[model samples]
Target: EAGVAQSPRYKIIEKRQSVAFWCNPISGHATLYWYQQILGQGPKLLIQFQNNGVVDDSQLPKDRFSAERLKGVDSTLKIQPAKLEDSAVYLCASSSVIGGEQFFGPGTRLTVL
Candidate 1:
């Protein structure tokens, strides 16, 4: 099976700007996740989705971050008024079942200036 796909492998934006990242999970996956990994730190889950509905988003920054899965296939994450603290690698992952082994995308590296 093909791996998860993500776009804009790298991005640079000024503080207070806006940016978006895209992800397409494996064809048959039922669960999707978004994670943020700062340099020298492990990835932190930002959100999870089951089909087109959000499963968890408590860790997501509601004031500046948002995400959505469309029809349970492709997902998008957006950050507005970006801050220096937001600079990190945003990873997308998917699994066939909850708590199952996950496949991850290459990730989009965001650099906030």
Candidate 2:
């Protein structure tokens, strides 16, 4: 079985620009998550999904960030009017159950100037 997959392994954009990232989770997995990792900090959960329904998004900035896991298999994360502080690696992870071991993708690294 394949692990998670993410696109545009790297991105560079100016502040106020828009960027989108894609993720395809493992087969049969029921949970998906998006995270942001800054240079010296651990990844912070931005959102989570269970079979196409949002499970958590408490830390996500609704004003500039959004995500969706349509069909419960693939997901997309978008950042509009990106900020310099938003430069980080956007990671996608998946698990079969809540609190289970999660499988992670290579991540999309964004550099906002």
Candidate 3:
């Protein structure tokens, strides 16, 4: 069996530039999530989706960050005019169903200059 997928595992950009990350969750998974982990801190949930519908995004920076789960499988996260404080690990996670353990990907590290 295959595992989760994440793209552009590392990225470096100017503070005002833009960046995007992609993820593909495991098959048959019903819940998908995106998280951001600042250095020295634990992962913080940015958004969650269930079958192409957004379930949560209260913590997401709507002014600069946006994400979507398409077809309930593939997902994408984008940041425009990236800020220095936004440098962190962008993680994509998924679970089989309610109460299922979330499996995380390798994560995409963003460095802002």
Highest lDDT among the candidates is held by which one?
1
* Model 2 spans with C-alpha error above 4 angstroms: none
lDDT of 1 at 75: 96
lDDT of each: 0.97, 0.96, 0.92
For all predicted structures, in order, the TM-scores are 0.98, 0.97, 0.96
Residues 1-113, candidate 1: write the lDDT tens digits.
78999999999999999999999999999999999999999999999999999999999999999998878999999999899999999999999988899999999999999
Q: Give the local distance difference test score of model 3.
A: 0.92
Give me the runs in candidate 1 sitting further than 4 Å from their true place: none
The TM-score measured for candidate 1 stands at: 0.98
Superposition error at 84 for model 1 (Å): 0.6
Instruction: Please provide, for model 2 over 1-113, each residue's C-alpha lDDT reduced to its tens digit, 9 standing for 90 to 100.
Output: 88899998999999999999999999988999999999999999999999999999999999999998878889999999999999999999999998899999999999999
Ordered by TM-score, highest first, the candidates read 1, 2, 3
Distance from true location, Cα of 38 in model 2, Å: 0.4
Model 1 weakest lDDT span, ten residues long: 66-75
For residue 98, what is the lDDT in candidate 1?
89
Tell me model 1's lDDT, rounded to 2 decimals.
0.97
* Candidate 3 structure quality by residue, lDDT tens digits, 51-71: 899989999999999898777
Pairs of colliding residues, candidate 2: none
TM-score of 2: 0.97
